[model samples]
Target: EDKVVQSPLSLVVHEGDTVTLNCSYEVTNFRSLLWYKQEKKAPTFLFMLTSSGIEKKSGRLSSILDKKELFSILNITATQTGDSAIYLCAVRPGTASKLTFGTGTRLQVTL
Candidate 1:
């Protein structure tokens, strides 16, 4: 079975603080690692790391993948209260578009 696990199930941060979320996985035929931010109805895509592209960044958020280590990390700098959300990590195989999701890391940013 393919699985992804995220550390620090919940975190509290003040505005302007930086945070890092960790994700480790054990997967069969792994093809890529995906990160998403869940705040409302559905998760919003943040990054997708594969063999050809192992790192991705956007504004205060960035993520990197290590296939050999079977893990990935997400970094958020200068977080604001608006950044409070559940961060999810998922893995996808070459044969399917469906992803196996982690339990998610909940972040709370206070002003």
Candidate 2:
């Protein structure tokens, strides 16, 4: 069975704290890994890591993928209260565009 799992499930941190979100997966013929930030509505794409783009970074957010281990990690530095959101990780199967998403990690940043 192909699945993605995120650890901790929830986290609490103060403003300006750095946090690491972990995602591990098991899938057949994995094509890529995607990261999303969820607030109220649908998730918003944060990063897409493939063989070509193994590492993606923007502002205080960055993510990296490991094809060999079938996992990825997202790092956020200098997080603020506005950064509080649910982080999602998904795997794209080689045969489909649909992504199988992890349960998600809820991050709460206190002011």
Candidate 3:
């Protein structure tokens, strides 16, 4: 079974602070790692990492994959109060679309 683990289950930061969340996985036939931000009920897609050493970025959020280590990291810079949310990391195999999600990291960005 594919398993994912996230470090620092929760975080507290003030506005403008930068944070980095880590995700590591163990599985067979690794396919991709996906990052998502959940502010409310639904989770919004953040990044998808398939290749190692490649960085994916959007605005203040960026992510990179280390396929050799079977892990990935998501970084958020200049965070705002609105950035407070639960960040999720999921891994999917190449043969199927089913994803195994990690125990999310909860981030609280205060004013």
Writing each residue's lDDT as its tens digit, candidate 1 over 34-66 gives 999999879999998986335688999999988
Best by TM-score: 3
Q: What are the per-residue Cα lDDT tens digits for candidate 2 across 1-111? A: 679999769999999999999999987788888999999888999999887436789999999987777778999999999889999999988988889999999999998
lDDT of 3: 0.94
Q: What is the lDDT of residue 66 in candidate 3?
A: 98
- Winning candidate number (lDDT): 3
2 versus 3: better lDDT goes to? 3
| lDDT tens per residue, model 3, 89-110 | 9999988899999999999999
RMSD of 1: 1.4
Model 3 C-alpha RMSD vs. true structure (Å) is 0.7
Clashing pairs in 3: none
Badly placed stretches (over 4 Å) of model 1 are none
Residue-pair clashes per candidate: 0, 0, 0
